[model samples]
Target: MHRVGLTGGIAAGKSTVAARLRRLGAAVIDHDVLAREVVAPGSSGLEAVAEAFGQEVVTVLGELDRAALGAQVFADPMARERLNAIVHPLVTEAAREREAAAVADGSTVVVHDIPLLVETGQAGHFDELVVVDAPPELRVQRLVASRGLTETQAWDRLAAQADDEARIAVADVVLDGSGAVSELEDQVDALWAVWADRHPAGSAR
Candidate 1:
């Protein structure tokens, strides 16, 4: 399979690129989805998180209270590191398993939509790394406008993620995400065409 890693900062439009790639026939393994799966209620991940951060971060209904946890970790580098240490490995293992299943199912192009690809040091695992590029300020505005986060909250979330320079430095393809949605989708379509040419369907790699 042609393993592609897709990543960007919060509100930088990585998910939009992944959705476009999905419509273009790439098998997408969204890591954020996997992350939630790994930490689902009654999971070892959730148990570990509770053990580390206490039950306060978990809801009465047994799911994670993301807002509570984010409030704790987003402002503290060490706490965020601890959270990553707990979750990243689990997410990686789950993603690897998911990719294996996709390959077995005859997937030729597999795009892993991982928001923390650079932070988790998984960029080298992909055949191509696509970073959706946007200025932090623009992303901050997007978050505030769309997600209802205060400007400070938006910046705090961005601060929790790896900076643009780090993501761009490791990127094989950088798609501009500062423009209109259609423009961004057009960039993804262009890249997907190149990828489809390189990894034709039903061809043994």
Candidate 2:
């Protein structure tokens, strides 16, 4: 199976690309969804998080209070690292299981949609790395408009991740997300064609 690591900064439209890839017949493993699942109520991930950051980050419903935890970690690098320490391993294992299942099922391509593939130093793990890129200013604008983040908060979020240059350096393919949605879709279609040539659909060994 062809393993593709897909990543981009916040609001860079990586999700759009991932969805398009799915529509074009790629098996997509969404790491963000796995991250949430790993920390769901009653999970060891949630327990570890609560142990590290205190019960204040858990809700009365026994769920993780993501916003509260975000407030604590986003402003502190060490806190963010600590949270990653608790969550990343679980996410990685879950992803590996899903990828293995896809391979066993004869899936041709598996796209791992990881938002922090670069920051976490996971780019080299994929057969090919695809990065969806947009200008930081554009991403900041999109974040403020769509997510209700203040300008400073948006910039802070951007600063918390690896920069465009760093992501691009590791990318075998870079899809420009600053243009129209159609353009991004076209890029995904082209990528799907290339992957199909490399490993024809339903032909995984």
Q: What is the lDDT, from 0 to 100, of the residue 177 in candidate 1? A: 94
Strongest candidate by lDDT: 2
| Candidate 2 positional error at 97, Å | 1.0
Off by over 4 Å in 2: 202-205
Cα error of candidate 2 at position 61, Å: 0.6
Clashes of each: 0, 0
Which tens-of-lDDT digit does each residue in 124-205 have in candidate 1? Answer: 9988899998999999999989999999989989998999999999999999999999999999878877876776672332
- Across 122-176, the per-residue lDDT of candidate 2 in tens digits comes to 9899999999999999999999999999999999999889889999998999999
Superposed on all Cα atoms, the candidates' RMSDs to the truth, in angstroms, are 1.8, 1.6
User: For each candidate, what is the lDDT?
Assistant: 0.89, 0.91
List candidate 1 segments past 4 Å from native: 202-205
